[model samples]
Target: MEYGQPQASTGGSVVRAILSLLPDWVEWTVLSLIAAWLVSLGAVQVWRRIQYCRAVRAGRPIHAAAQYGQGRGADCLGSYAPPRRPDADGD
Candidate 1:
């Protein structure tokens, strides 16, 4: 019975006791890992789209973006390979 000071509660606060089992730092670490995974997933999708568009414009096979000339042949406008001519021998 102290003046101006609150007496300790006789009844147990069960909810608080349970929450103290795990530290706050562990929760924050898990949240950060999940956020990073989602960001990387979005970035990978964007990169694939850019490669697909380049392949279509260059007239290279759509399925293989890497086959398109990695050299200077491609520009803003496409530089498709010249159409093949029929061989003179007709082989």
Candidate 2:
């Protein structure tokens, strides 16, 4: 409140000073997690593109993928099979 004096402590400055105590790895961990998420997203896009190309070549109709897949899918049909029901389930 004095004409020429400045306040020694304020809430924002105190919070900023406290933030400097965090270790370097905390920042790297956050960055690493973000980078990992982005990399995985890019990988999924590339995979979908390859599968779409295959579908076009095979003439299965891309609309089948969109309609049945709700516009999204990752079915490697040739490499996997659906589960077969056991005879006991019929009893």
Candidate 3:
């Protein structure tokens, strides 16, 4: 209340200081997680491309869905009934 004297901060100043620091920590953690995810995605894409190139060089047609039996089921001619197992019910 004196002239030329600065006002002193109360207990709220400590709370404000802690609150301000919290955002910086949260921002850094989120940034690190996003960066890691992007790097992993890029690595997976490169690996897939390498595999595709290798398959092409081996004189075999590279069919992505071939592993799931896409065209191979045409011989059934609509008579295909999906195989059922008795244990599929988790009993």
Candidate 4:
């Protein structure tokens, strides 16, 4: 009736015996490969999310205050200034 001892059942005894015979290196390698794959997937998902945010922010309208046709001359009407560069210095 020890807490850590295997139960007296056929399947449990088989599982316990197999676990005792497994090599430590085999277990470690399997666990490491699984962990590496999960980390790589997470990095790819984060990169995709960043790209999506950039695309959405790029497509947003520039200004609410300025008239659609304000700056350009009579023939050149209805165009706003080009989208500002995110990385620009205030020049």
Candidate 5:
């Protein structure tokens, strides 16, 4: 290459150019999605904390084996069961 010639585009320069062309709404949409995800995560944590507090107040065993299905599968608890999809099996 000649000394006066321009250099080829690097990965960083290409990415910066692409990002500069995106509309403002695209950035806002991404920020909104991130915010929603964070809020949902916080809500889940709060729900867990409330449940833990209730368990303590009710004198429930937090680590009891029976709570997690004793010696059988999780479905053995009867309170919780996974929904079966009709198309799960290739019947």
Candidate 6:
């Protein structure tokens, strides 16, 4: 009966209500699955970094974008090629 004010609950509340109806084990299982998935993704990234470093150290030609090295300024293990200027190649 209040004007310019919504009275119905949002979808988030409905989702929470449904989730509350689930068993504790179900919540734990979902949380564990999410954690495992995130950890696996991180592992894959670490592996890729290792391969990239090895390639750089071995003097192999890497087909990476010029901007890729700038973002990896410090966190990079050994070293990477510095990012090129946008107009350096006259692109």
Q: Best-fitting candidate, measured by lDDT?
A: 6
Q: What would the per-residue lDDT of candidate 5 be over residues 1-91, giving only the tens digit for each residue?
A: 7999777679868966776788889867876998999999999999989988999999988656444323446445576766646774422
Which residue pairs collide in model 4, if any?
none
Q: Look at candidate 1 and tell me the lDDT of residue 73.
A: 32
lDDT of 6: 0.75
Question: What range of 10 consecutive residues in model 5 has the weakest lDDT sum?
Answer: 66-75
Highest TM-score among the candidates is held by which one? 6
Query: What Cα-based lDDT does every candidate model obtain?
Result: 0.65, 0.69, 0.73, 0.70, 0.74, 0.75
Model 6 spans > 4 angstroms off:
1-15, 64-91
Q: Mind giving the per-residue lDDT tens digits that candidate 1 earns over 11-83? A: 5455445446657786567668889999999999999999889989999787543443443333334556554
Off by over 4 Å in 2: 1-21, 65-91
Q: Kindly indicate the candidate among 1 and 3 with the higher lDDT.
A: 3
For lDDT, candidate 3 versus 5, the one ahead is 5
| lDDT tens digits, residue span 1-68, model 3 | 69897765877688566657778888678769989999999999999999999999997778756554
The order of the candidates by TM-score, greatest first, is 6, 5, 2, 3, 1, 4
Q: Model 1: how far is 19 from its true place, Å? A: 9.5
**TM-score of each model, paired residue for residue:** 0.45, 0.47, 0.46, 0.42, 0.48, 0.49
How close to the true structure is residue 22 of candidate 2, measured as C-alpha lDDT? 63
- Tell me the number of clashing residue pairs for each predicted model: 0, 0, 0, 0, 0, 0
| Tens-digit lDDT string for candidate 4 (1-91) | 7999766899878866775677988767766998999999999999978877877799954443456544323324435556547895433
Residue 61, candidate 1: alpha-carbon lDDT: 84
- Candidate 3 vs. true structure, TM-score: 0.46
